[model samples]
Target: MNSWVNASKFFTGASTVGSIAIPAILKHAGIIGWGALAMELSSFFIFVIAIMCYMSMYDEDGYSSMI
Candidate 1:
């Protein structure tokens, strides 16, 4: 749907800016190495949470349509 497309675009743009800005901000504070580590750990946790959420969406009886 158009709404989904727009939402995806917005998130993609926001994350792109954040990916660039966050590291620069950390570098300015003189801790770029630790910042990169923190970002990686956060990304891993987010991936795990997304997988859990997707798994939870299925009905116990079997697969079900969200729509």
Candidate 2:
């Protein structure tokens, strides 16, 4: 299908281009140093918070359209 093909292309492009930048960003942020574990845990918490915020938009009683 066209959607699958497009998704594959996008994933491939992102994997090739975006993957390299992660290491550079981590190094610059000292995430690869002594505080790596703490930084990783903090990042996980941030991701969870963002997910909670996003999911709150779909709360059943909060918004009729979102439900």
Candidate 3:
């Protein structure tokens, strides 16, 4: 679990750096809009997946109890 947590942190940091760097690289290449759109979609999918994972942590009974 600790290893997983450390790996997650490392990837999260790499993701942050890439998010900052990729746009500028794309803009220099003359595809800023396309690159930005792709990044936005990627972020949205990551968000959805994170939400799904969070929801899955709750059992059926636990989910019902939320309401």
Candidate 4:
């Protein structure tokens, strides 16, 4: 009967921890999703910044030149 009591205690502890952790796991995944999106958008912004810099540097006597 002691073994049964120990087994019950173990499962009860595991269930309690699992109940607390499931929502935390989902929240972590959601945060990672947004982090990935932010990383992608930052890369896109870097490309845009590079293009603007290149364009501004290519002006010829206030005249626009196409590359």
Q: In each prediction, how many residue pairs overlap at the backbone (N, C-alpha, C within less than 3 A)? A: 0, 0, 0, 0
TM-score of each: 0.44, 0.43, 0.44, 0.43
Cα lDDT computed for each candidate against the true fold: 0.76, 0.71, 0.79, 0.70
Q: Residue-wise lDDT of candidate 3 within 1-67, one digit each (tens)?
A: 9999999999989987777677767777887687585777688679879988989986788668788
The full ranking of all candidates by TM-score, starting with the best, is 1, 3, 4, 2
**Candidate 1 lDDT over residue span 1-67, tens digit each:** 9999999999989986776677668767887687585776577568769989989975676645443
TM-score for candidate 2, residues paired by index: 0.43
Q: Return whichever of 1 and 2 wins on TM-score.
A: 1
Local lDDT at 54 for model 1: 88
Candidate 2 deviation (Cα RMSD): 6.5
lDDT of 2 by residue, 1-67 (tens): 9999999999988864555556557778876864664566566568769989999877777557674
Off by over 4 Å in 1: 33-67
Q: Tens digit of lDDT per residue, candidate 4, span 1-67?
A: 9999999999988975665465456557785465555565566568769989999988686645443
In model 4, what lDDT does residue 66 have?
A: 47
Runs in model 2 lying further than 4 Å from the true structure: 33-67
Candidate order (lDDT): 3, 1, 2, 4
Tell me, by lDDT, which candidate is best. 3
